[model samples]
Target: MGHLFSNYYEAVSVILFGIGFTTLLLNRNMIKKIMGFNIMDTAIYLFLAAKGYIFNRKVPIVTGEVPTPEQYINPIPAGLVLTGIVVSVSVTAVMLSLTIRLYRRYHTLDIDEITRLVKEEK
Candidate 1:
């Protein structure tokens, strides 16, 4: 049962990664591109958090039980993922702001149309 649950989490993370990649490739809108990047980031964090869960294992830290290294999964990945999420959030904010600015300047969100307009002006 534990093994099945673990595999399911791993599978979901992999699927998330695949979806993010596909969205990034197929979408032309800047907002969609940023969303895809955020989706990939979320998948990475999910993978890390899943890795931190232990089956039938108590939390690490010596109280009365002898600490067994094998019983606990590393928590560093989870911490790193937290930091990654923060950074990704900041990046998304900046990207969206830029997208808004671009939209205001061009009055259209279509990438191909924007490019054409700029080329014609040049």
Candidate 2:
């Protein structure tokens, strides 16, 4: 029980990743695909944050007293996740904008319909 409890965040992250991947693969709507991408991105961020966490450790800030490396939780993963979040938001915005364009031009958000229209055009 304790072992499983300790890894709860990781477990949830894995579940979110699986769900996102499934949605991305199975969904036909462009908006649903974008949502799945966001979900996958959040899962990755959670996994990285969980990996960076340390039991009974302080934040990765140094004080007047000299502190060893292990005195604080590792900061690399957190930093990377922060950057990932920014990039993810930008990507999501772009995807949503493209989806809007597709909807305006194709009159539908369904991937199959859009592809069919494109093929008809050529």
Estimated TM-score for each candidate:
0.78, 0.86
lDDT by residue for model 1 over 4-32, one digit each (tens)?
67599877888898888787777878878
Per lDDT, the best of the predicted structures is: 2
The per-model lDDT (C-alpha) reads 0.82, 0.93
lDDT of 2 at 79: 90
Best-fitting candidate, scored by TM-score: 2
Off by over 4 Å in 2: 1-5
Name the runs in model 1 displaced over 4 angstroms.
1-6, 58-73
What are the clash counts of all predictions, listed in order? Answer: 0, 0
What lDDT does model 1 reach? Answer: 0.82
Cα deviation of 5 in candidate 2 (Å)?
4.1
Tens digit of per-residue lDDT, candidate 2, span 6-101: 899998999999888888889999899989989999999999999999999999998899999979999999899999999999999999999999
